[model samples]
Target: MTASARPWVLALGLLTALRLVAAMMLPPAPDEAYYWIWGRALALSYYDHPPMVALWTAAGSGLLGDTALGLRLLGPLSVAVASVLLARAGNALFPASGAGYWAAALLNGTLLFSAGSVLMTPDTPLLVFWCAALWAWVQAHLRQDGRWWLVFGVLAGCALLSKYTAAFLGLGVLIWMIAAPRARHWFRDWRLWAGGILAVVVFSPVLVWNAQHDWVSLVKQGGRAGSVGTGSALRYLGELIGGQIGLATPIIFVLCVAGIAVACRRFWRGDAAAGLLAAATIPAALVFLWQSTGSRVQGNWPAILYPSACLAAAGYLSPRWHRWRRWGISVGLVLTAMVLLQAALAPLPLPRRSDPTLARLGGWQDFANRVEELRLERGASFVAAEEYGLASELALHLPRGTPVIALGDRWDLFNLPEPPPGGRGLLIRSTRRGEAEPLWPQSEPAGEVSRRREGIEAERYRIYNVTVIGDGPRKVALPSRR
Candidate 1:
């Protein structure tokens, strides 16, 4: 590695450092909890996502145990890999000395760093695999090397295993080939189609699992997007663009589009690599814009676009912006500072800023512990929940025999073996009720047990301890306490 190569090393190091910083600071989201649960189970597929994320989660847990840092270690490690791949792909596209390094650096400062890099989720792993696949595809395209097609096949397969979102890449690439006269030869290549078969093989398990579950995952995700209409659609698109501004600075986003225009000319002149960046963005943006017409969209739905955008920005800026290197550095620093400040302000209160469904994240484990004490004192049979997310998290931490049951539709995430024995169950809610009627006539509330404070700090519904006084063998009596 020489002078130009040193920047690649520095960029990689910076990405890894940032990942470490975020892993140490950021808390896990509900999705992380769900995936962590998958890790604990070590299943082939999850109800919501494929097993790749579960593998990442398990790796984190195996190394760090079930702590925040443990859950996030793999996520940041993934960002490091994505950064390296981005650098290599950029180098392949441009003739500049350190173009790849600059491309990776530009990616480092965007919201991609925060969401895909810092916050560990299924997408984090998928992004890494996707970047790697794209890099391999570019190499194969440029060198006409048949063997790289097999590499692309394996990576594409892994990307699909990571997330269903990788379909966009195939679609985008296909369109790019059909539209470009010079690259039309890709259709005649046997290895290209062989790669598609490889992706199918890697993704088949999840496909089978979804089939077994009646494709519930697809229905759930589709319903989520379509459920929001008109007003929310407009709002979602606005936020989508807003998120893009934060993730890939407004200036960089603008420059990337211009870069795509310039890259298109090169592609027309048979520079196959130039089309890769534009192919990723143009089609994804079109789809995003189309979806925005009816349903609200998530900003990160098209997160796959970030890598290409980075490449585009590098292309647009290298010629003119590189001339003013000092000015570019100053501007880049200012933009990064502003974005970090915004992310900090955006989620200042942690989980509260994320999702309210989760029990006020603060002191939740303490609450879980208190419930445990009462359950043990009274020798409770099982723990029932009004919500699934909370029930799932509590189940993870609670004593093994203490079954957590979901009383509502949200509990669909958990697969219960059967109802608690004798139709009698212990209800867990955040309220004051000593005893109440159970769902079955045979079951009734026995006594109340719970922890209460001055006010609900995080809008966690009042947790209640209701004893179902019904016909069943008395394991232990609820203590006579207030």
Candidate 2:
């Protein structure tokens, strides 16, 4: 590596090492455990997301076993690669002002990316492939080479496999091609059409999987588009903006907004690079902004916009903004470090409801152990929960070969083994977020367990002794032993 590249590599390597340590230190969140179960099953797609996260988890755990480090191994590694690719893309897009290194640093410093790097989730793979696609597109535009389009296509396909939200990226690219005068000529390029075809071809597995499953996955995710807010639209919009500010960190969010405004001005002045960045971000930003006016938009839903947005922010030329950029990174890193520490060790004396890390990641192992003791005492054949997250967590922490059943309709979509008819099991129901009723007719309160982290109770669950009286349609299922 060149002398200049060495610092970037070393810095990224150190950050990755710290993330891996955090991954190993903290227990898997319920969502992480759910995705880990997906990895165990290895489906073409899933009821919630496409198969990329499953594939990534499977690869990580296959090599490192079912440990937290194993399941989350790729998250940090992928983010490191993403940071490098984003740096290159920034440099290629704006050569002056060292926007490349600043982009990389700014991205790493963000709470969304920093905290996300240690968690095995759909967003993990999506962010990496998103950066890769941006890099490929930048190379293609700068070199005016059609071959890079093919690379962009593959990365775009991978991003789609990671999450359905990736469709917006493709939409943004189309807008750029149509709106930017310099890029309009690509409409006549055969390779451009070929690249589009290649993306669809690569995404065919998900289509086939959905086709076989009655397009259930597509229907489920697509339904979110039609949801309207029950409360005032302004309330939801405020929440959405507040969430982004907190997730991005206030100073960084300010930088991004300022940079986007600058890019918008340059775009109308016929600057192709600025237009490309603006086009890539505006479509998704507007969609989410509109969605917030109707329904609650997830803070992370706009994650795809950050690669180009950060690049734009890094490229913004202003003495005052440059000073703010430095402070932004410093403050962001401090906030990120605090979150990591809180997740790993609940040092702060916050209430369980107030501390998100405690609510999601705390006390799972202890909770599983207590549930297992109850199961054995009741002579139950399997353990069951009405929630998928609870069931998946039980599956991860319960003894090997223990049958953990998710008593829900979604479990029917999985290829796991059906629960035995006329069997007895322990049913767990959370008092805080209970959604489903008991499936079995014969159920009685057996015990109650409180999930606690650092002496603070996060949740309370009631355990029931349930005996299946008949082979009803609501019967749960369990995965076969690996």
Candidate 3:
């Protein structure tokens, strides 16, 4: 609001705008391309997530003419909006002190700024709406205003539509209710109920879509989680913890831990909202805890909790000690520098464009030429991979609706009920096999396909041609009836 504040906000905005410009031009991440297909098709649900990611990409493509910039424009734009809302929400939530600025700064420098809002993923949009919704709820609670609740309703609805992960917010809210007595008083408020109904209304499309498709969305998510062996829960948990450290940065994580401890001790006993904020992150934490038991967990799965993490940190650190204020800026700068360095080297190994290591590890565009070659040779009709990661990359390289499939991963592209009947299919695998080999071989092969062993850094993919048998005894019916 002040001139000093205006410049800080503007600087953040500028930084975001600059990053987005890069994102706009940067090649689509494999996952983004896969989701882009969903957007092109305009489905209610896909094998991976609700349709919101698809809808956002489709809308961007339609409006911006479907270039790489079109695909990623929404990334920075959402983060910018989220930054604004987070500042506003922090101010409203903690009006007396100047802690809100720190909250904004902390979020700007953390993983949320680096990944979600900048990556153009479904989580970016969800985070935007999630922050807005929380801000709206704070406004409504503080003022007892129906208008804020209405806005909150819409935001919650949109958040739900963006990703089912939004449901974790409900868990957070419920935890807040149980832990903070003051929040319990709002139970009889009509606005709260109305807001709930509105959220359901806004998120209804995903539910309806899921129902029509036999809840395949649920099945897909469950399968993904289960794919990680339950025995590796500790490794998964360790990765999650390490990821949080990287994502939140040590400074903010420490602040959040202090904030939570303070809230639990000084605030939770009396203030319900603070308690609610602390409670909201539990579901995600618990899910990670459960997931850790099975397989290596991704650090980003718990990304949704960072807002609360930051909020809690802000609350705890601000009141306890203003002495370390200068240190905060120094830490933020160091973390920001690290992130920028990573981004600068994003197109690693120089102009080679074929880093098999990065490609196998989620940087498929490193072999853009190979992907392009396959698309050109195969006529871009049917491309499938044994891994979703590869399939996702193909989705980006191949033309829209090229019918990319995931074989060995229990995600059968050909399993769809009405996928183009029989087309030439290109298979990219780590193992060598004729078309007759079972997609999911019971054991890891003696070694990966010979192509993967090639000296070409990006030539890890081995291609094979196969004809998809349609409507035979062996054919798995696509879920058209569902």
Highest lDDT: give the candidate number: 2
Best by TM-score: 2
**Can you tell me which runs of candidate 2 are displaced by over 4 Å?**
433-437, 469-473, 480-482
In candidate 2, position 239 carries an lDDT of: 93
Cα lDDT tens digits, model 3, 224-334, are: 666767455566677778778767666666676677677666543687667656675666777777767777667666777767666766756654555444465457556
TM-score of each: 0.80, 0.97, 0.80
Off by over 4 Å in 3: 219-228, 290-296, 318-357, 360-368, 371-389, 398-426, 431-459, 468-482
Top-down TM-score ranking = 2, 3, 1
lDDT of 3 at 73: 75
Candidate 2 vs candidate 3: the lDDT winner is 2
RMSD of 1: 6.2
Clashes of each: 18, 0, 11
In TM-score terms, candidate 3 sits at 0.80
Residue lDDT tens for model 1, 154-257 = 89889888877787778877987887676788788898888888888988887887888788776776576456475766776787778777556665566666
Judging by TM-score, tell me the better candidate of 1 and 2.
2
